[model samples]
Every structure is written in C-alpha cells, then in structure tokens.
Target: MPRAQQIRSRSISASPFLKWAGGKNQLLKDILPRLPEKISVYYEPFIGGGALFFALASQRRFKKAVIGDRNPVLVDAYQTVRDDVEALIEQLGPHAAHATDAEYFYWMRALDPSSMSRVERTARLLFLNKTCFNGLFRVNRRGQFNVPFGRYKNPTVLNPDLLRACSEVLQGVDIVEGDFEALAERAGPNDTIYFDPPYVPLSATSSFTAYDRHPFGRSEHARLARAYRACLARGATALLSNSDCEETRKLYRGLWVETVAATRAINVVASKRGQVNEVLVVGRRQSAPALRQVGASGHAVTSSSSLRRSRAAG
Candidate 1:
C-alpha cells in the first residue's frame, strides 16, 4: 500500500481526534495534490481541528512545524495532547464512563476551563466539544463556551489511542495562542504556511466566523492578506482557504485563486448543508528550486495561476 493509504488505515490514530466545524479533512483530496512535495518548516496560524497539519504529519512532510490559533481553549487542548496526553487521557476516564449523562455534561460545560489544570482543562474542552450541539466551538462576548448540549447517540467521549497518536505527531510542533499575524515573526525561507482562517460567510445570515469574541471581519481579512504577502516576501510558501466570494477574491487579487466544492457540515438548517464552492489561494513561489518542484508535480500553480482559475473537483 502507498504511504497515504497506510496512514488512512490507522484512522483511529492518524485522523483528527476531534470533530471540527469547517474542517479540511473532506477537502484533502483537493488539497494534498496541490501541496509542494518538499517543505522545511510548516506553519498553520488558524489551526482549527488541525486536519491538514495531522495529514501532513501522517505523511512525514515537514522538518519542523508551528501551529497557532486565536482560541485559547483549542491551544490548550493541543498543548495538553503534545505534553500531557497520558494525564489528559486519565482525566477523561471518569467523563467517558458517564458520557451519556446530561447532568454531568452540563456540569462539565459550566466548569470554567481557565480555573483548571492543563490536563483537566483539555479534558473538559474535549468532553464539552463532543457533547455540545454539533460540536460547535462558539463562545460569547465574555469568552464563555455557551453552546447547549447536543443530541447524539453514543458519542465517543475519549479515544486514548487516537490521543496518543496525535501526541506522537505533535512532538516537535510549537503550539501558540494569538493572532494569525504572529506567523510573520517566525516564518522564514522554505517555510510552508497554510491559513485556514474563519471563512467569510457566503450569505448575510450565515455568519459563522465567531470562534471567539473577535469576529474575523473585512479588516481582519485584509490584515491576513497583508500577512500572507509578508510571509511570501520573506520567501515562505503559503496557501489559504476561504469562502469563494467576490470580496475574498478581491482581497486576494493577483494571487492563485481557485474554487473547490466543500461540504457544508455545520449549518443549523439541514437544508443549507451541502456542497459549496470554497476558494484556495496559493502565493507566489520565490525560490527557483521550489518552482521546479511544483512543475514536476504537474500542478504548476503560481501567483499567476489565478488568471486561469482552475476549477477544483471536489
């Protein structure tokens, strides 16, 4: 079997342990082929669910990696998995035993994650995330997790093997919490940065960008585009994902922008959940050798590739 197939066979361990909204797992087929074969350092600023990171790790793609997210709880979970997986698994034992208990679920949800230890906090988040409505990671103005309990049958509260696998993959990864612009400080030549920021809503009532109190509005998008350009200026290869809207296209004007179908899995209305076109923007390649590698791969996507606008098959 091929390496990718081998990795997929260990689904329990190789795959993302948590279910995430706007996860890239479903789009990997449309993504992996486009990724440059050789990468030195990998960076994912908005590391929600980290599906791409995990997949790359499974393939042993990069030399070193740094992943960050604005959401502190998500960062804590990643840190706990990297540094204290065993303890986190232990902390989740009791919660797993009482997984289906609604009273325990609410009690765990109300318990402030800030007040707990690292392992306890991660366990709390994982339990609440799995039990919450559709596993939505939304918070209010005060940064409090407010999603209500979910309706599901026999949810997997804890998976020790998968957590262990994730921990192993995150061994050398530097996990951080803060704005996406932080990547500008760490990114260097030959580094690969994938930006999976909160998508600009497709419609007026479809706002789902609120991962925390700070919504990713137009200004944020513009700032991210600047950051992307800055990374490219420093000789880093960057790929970004966003809603395939006119504004997003305009924001990333003069870059490689292509549309791919992404399944809408997190919509409140079931009728609205289906295939939707999402944009994939690839930045300019600076190094001659890197450009050669892209050509060898046959994709040959560059800053000017946006002009052709290759339609990505979902």
Candidate 2:
C-alpha cells in the first residue's frame, strides 16, 4: 500500500483547526449541494480553513484530494498537523496557558518564524491564530504577523483529539504551498476544483484581502478568473465562491452563478457582521454523459442538461 494511504484512519471525525477569515463553515450547506456527484480528484486551491475539504473528506467524496494555499505558514501548519500532531500539541500547550497574556502573545508573535523549526513555526501560527484579534492571519507588506491580541477570556488553543482526527483525514492527501493558478492547472477530466480566493471588497473601504503580503487586487482577481475558465476548458469541474458584486458577476458571466446568502462575522465594523450575498460559480464538462449534482441531503438532484441550461440562461 502507498505510504499516504497506509496511515488512513476513518474512525475519528476531523474539522478545521484554525480560525480563518472567510472560512466556508457557514456556507457549506449551499456549497455542498452543488458538488458533482462523482469526483475522481478534488482540488481546493485557496484552502483557508478547509471547512469544505474536511466535510467532503468525511463523506469520502473523492478518490484523491490535493489542497494548497499561498500562505506558507498556513501550509506548514497543515503539514505539521498531519505529520506531527503530538509535537505540535506539546509546543502549543505553553501558548494556550499564556493565551490571555498580552505580553506573552506579542512576544511570541514578534519572534521570527524564519528562525524557528518547522514544528515551531506551525505551533506559533496556531497559537497566534487562536489568540490574535478576530483570529485573523493578516500580514504586513514585509510578510509579518500583524494582528493584535484577541483578549478573549478563555480560548481553546490546543485540542489533541481534533488534531489527531485532522491528521487522520489528511493521510495520503497532497498538501501544497503555492499559487492557486498553478494548482488549478493540475486538474483534468473527472477532477473537481473549488476556488475560494480572497473576496472582492463590497466597498472601497471594506477591502481586507491581505491574508498574506501579496495583495489580491483587481489584477489578481482577473488572473484567478482566467484560471477558473481555463480549468473548465480543460474538462475539470470548476466551482468558485466570491463576493456577490458587479465585478465578480461580470468576471464569471455566462457561468452557472448562484447567489447564496452568507453571514459575515470577521468584519472590523460590528454592524457589517450580518447577512451578505455571495456567488457560487460552477462549471462542468459538457462532454460528460451525465454530470450528477449532489444536494444538501447527499442525494443526487440534477443532471448535466439542467446545469447547462442554467449556465445558458445566466
């Protein structure tokens, strides 16, 4: 048996370990229903919290899973969780004990990740993610961890059971750190790819795409749109989630775009933490005999013809 598959453990359930911005835990209901019934390989390029990926893994929805992210720290954390959950938990225990201390939090945050080992770096990221302001993983122009202390009275920084479960789910899966465009290029026929790029700001002032040092501005979004289209052209089933705005709609025009209501909680402005509309753009290969779509209840609901009609009417 392959080394990746040899470590698989199906008895435990797994979920996202970090609190990520724009995590799709809330939108899984709408997103889950639209997935192709049969997926040979699954690709999630912008795997923020991997809410959708973990959910799909639990269902054994794909034969192979390839998940990647632009943030190296985030990617490292995933790898650490999969490869060395016990060591990560050991390192994180001290941080959890001092999570409420502002001085300790900033001290750990200010430490250079480049100077630490792989396990240390992952532990640092998990610690900051749990204790940072709003649990956001924002970086400065120089790629520095910049979010302030969250000041929560009690924060669960280490969950050994959750980490072990996540590790089991990650067995035999590809965890990469790189550009989404490059990752999307790997998808081909019978493959399903989900793109959850940094969303376009609703307004000029609401922009917060700085998940890393690189700014996901207009050009980046355009690049992503081109990638998404290219994936569809290559016979890969492509699905994308983005803000329901004129720019997003314009970019994904003529595709099967469905507006789904999502609740936003990460906004700095308290009033903006309410219901908002987001678009899910889906594209499947026309040559497929019968592309089946799974509904929220895990039942196949629609066929390729109806999906094509929806795209045509868009």
Give one clash count per candidate, in the order shown: 0, 0
User: Each model's RMSD to truth, in Å?
Assistant: 5.7, 4.0
lDDT of 1 by residue, 165-189 (tens): 7887888899999988986567878
Cα lDDT computed for each candidate against the true fold: 0.79, 0.84
143 in model 1: Cα distance from truth in Å? 1.3
TM-score, every prediction: 0.87, 0.89
Off-target runs (Cα >4 Å) in candidate 2 are: 1-12, 284-314
**Residue pair clashes in candidate 2:** none
lDDT of 2 by residue, 261-305 (tens): 889879787898899888888763243234345556655565443
Q: Could you say which candidate leads in lDDT?
A: 2
Model 1 residue 231 lDDT score: 86
Q: lDDT score of model 2?
A: 0.84
Which number leads on TM-score?
2
Candidate no. 1 TM-score: 0.87
